[model samples]
Target: MIIEKLLFHTFIILAPVLIQTSLLEHHKWSKSPIFTGVLNGLATLTCLAFTYEFAGLYWDFRYVPLIIAMVYGGRKAGLIVLAFMLIGRTIMGGDILFHGLASAVIASLIPYYFSKGFWKMSPVKRVVAAQFIGLWPIAIIFLMLFVFHLPSQFLSELHSITFILQFGLVQVLGIGIAARLNEWMVEKKVMREEIIKSEKLNTLGELAASIAHEVRNPLTVVKGFLQLMKRQSKGEEDEYLAIILSELGRAEEIINDYLNFAKPQFEKVERVHIKEILSEVSILLNAYAVKECFFGEPPGG
Candidate 1:
């Protein structure tokens, strides 16, 4: 019977986690800090609503969601989720409401203060730290019970080693699962960026190759004509010929630089009109668009 309740509650707690994971996977909203905070806040509220009943008291992996929000989403997310939980608990109005509110505040701070250090820690340490941090809220609630001099039955139920250990284990497992999911999301994002970069580099290489081939042919023709002019020039024109030859050599060097995938540096900087570039691009695109449309039309029409 005890094991069945634990399994049922575990499933309830994880349902939101699965939904949250799917949201992260499908939507780009996670990139926005505010949106991410609001999303995680909703997840925490869901966890709260599905609390597991034990010994006439409620327990849920509510802090698990908040910890994840703060650790990965930062202080903004933590505070937002905390606010949601506190507001919901206050509205519910029970003897444990104040205790729940205090625990929620502590839970928010644990990740806000330690998230940076948590990420820096080894994987084993991270799991250990998460478990410890995750369970601190329950610890606080128990302490508050003693402090408030709650009824004997309430104290007795909480005081049981079995209850403590069971709940502690739940916290540890939930934290571990949340932390792993966070790591997986980060890895997926990084992998996507890397794939995009590789594709861009490949496209750049193809463009460079095409430009080098087309430009080299025209440069070669121009150089050949200049060499012919130099050979036929008189003494007075020789200085001008030397200047022309030198410029042609520089142009060849620029072409070679392009072929080698290096940026061509100009000896003189000149102001280029943006309108001229736009006009050139427009003309080129207009020709391609006309050709494509001409072919796209029906044979009879």
Candidate 2:
């Protein structure tokens, strides 16, 4: 019977995380800081709501939710969850209310202060870190236990040594499950984003190939006409035609770059003289400037 209740409470504690995983693909704010804070705060509230009687007071793994909010959502989220925790405690007005508040304040500081480093840790280290931080609140509770100096019989009878140990172990297990679930959720989200990005790149590649092939066909027709003109032209006109053909060839190379998106083919390395390039550009610019009258001085003036 006792084991069954503990399992039930554990389910209540983990209910939010389990639900978030089920809606992993659908939720928009599932992993946001404010959302994380709200979810964990809801978990704390649920734990508080369904608390079981132990040691003549209500008991729950509410702090595990608070720690989780801190670990994943950082300090802002931790404070949000902490506020919910304090509110719940105030509303309940149960045994040792002030002690509960004090324990919460003291316990929460550990995780809230150190959450920045939590993401840098490995999964195993994260679980261990959460477990270690979870122990602080429990330790605070124990310290309160000693400070209040409850009767020896009350301690021995209501909260036996074995049960106390089991409580600590259960909190440890609870935090481990929370942190692990978060890690799993993050991995799934990352994989989905990668798939989306790959698909977009593939779409862009296909578009480039289609457009390049279409443009290359028109360029081929133009090149054929230019070659015909090159054969018929004389002297200076022939030189100008050659320059046009050279520029047409460079345009084809650019189209090839677009067509072969997956793998690029490099052309043979040929030594190019600066004088020939400058002369070609100057002649082309001079013709364009005379024809269009767009340039006031022309290139390389």
Candidate 3:
């Protein structure tokens, strides 16, 4: 735990440098690495103290690492968050000494809940979940802190209320932006896949049309000869000649079905009885029907 806290502090010091180098390479920054690291460390430590001293101030800082790690990295980022949390608590001498640590623990656990449900969420929804999880527990902490002490000269009830509201608004906006970025990436990937698939389908449709045209001419010639043979026969022709022609017609219908499948078609839907359609199909296939479809008990039963 002690080692983890040290690593958390180290991450806070270096995270900006790591982020700027890895993600912000194309973007310009006026800050230097050493300066940025020191500033981030100081600022993070200050916020940790404030959150420890005040009940709900932790709301301002909860999801920073979680969002960064989850978006850019993965579960390892959660460890960074947990490490920072423990370090922040230990530095302030734990919640017991601070009088508000108990509240902070509940407040801090919100992000973990978000992480647990991360896989189930869409990009936009994941951001919303992180935002809500980060801020909702702050209300409980605020109530705990507020009720314990009366407002002093500098801190009034109105001031605390305004701060809470503003804090929440900022959180929502930040998470919203991050979530939008994630969703944009997802949309881009989907569009790329659709374009590739459309190209492949277009090529296939052209090839099928060419093949169908070539086959249809030979099929027609064969049908013509069969018809001539029927007309010239004196004795009763083969009994199955009619069946052969019928099967040929069915084959042509199947080819038509395939052609239609290759080309897109739109249907205008009207309300109709699905059960009635099924019964009609069954009637047409009576000779081939092997089993009856039942809604309930069998007729004999």
Q: lDDT per residue, candidate 1, 1-301, as tens digits?
A: 5555655555644554465567557677656657666766776676677666665466666777677677767777777878888887787778777666876787677678887666787666676777677776777656765666555766466456576677778667867776776666666778999999999988887788788778888878887887898799888787887887788789778878767764544789989999999999999899898987887877677
lDDT of each: 0.71, 0.81, 0.54
Ranking by TM-score: 2, 1, 3
Worst 10 residues of 3 by lDDT: 30-39
What does the lDDT read for residue 2 in candidate 2? 57
In terms of lDDT, which candidate is stronger, 1 or 2?
2
The residue pairs found clashing in candidate 3 are 95-101
Expressed as tens digits, the lDDT of each residue in 127-156 for candidate 3 is 677666655555665576566556463266
Candidate 1: give the clashing pairs.
Answer: none
**lDDT score for candidate 2 against the true structure:** 0.81
Q: Which candidate is the best by lDDT?
A: 2
lDDT of 2 by residue, 215-273 (tens): 99999999999999989888899988899999989999999876776454577877899
- What residue runs in model 1 are displaced by over 4 Å at the alpha carbon? 53-57, 115-129, 145-159, 234-301
lDDT of 1 at 179: 71
lDDT ranking from best candidate downward: 2, 1, 3
Clash totals for all candidate models: 0, 0, 1
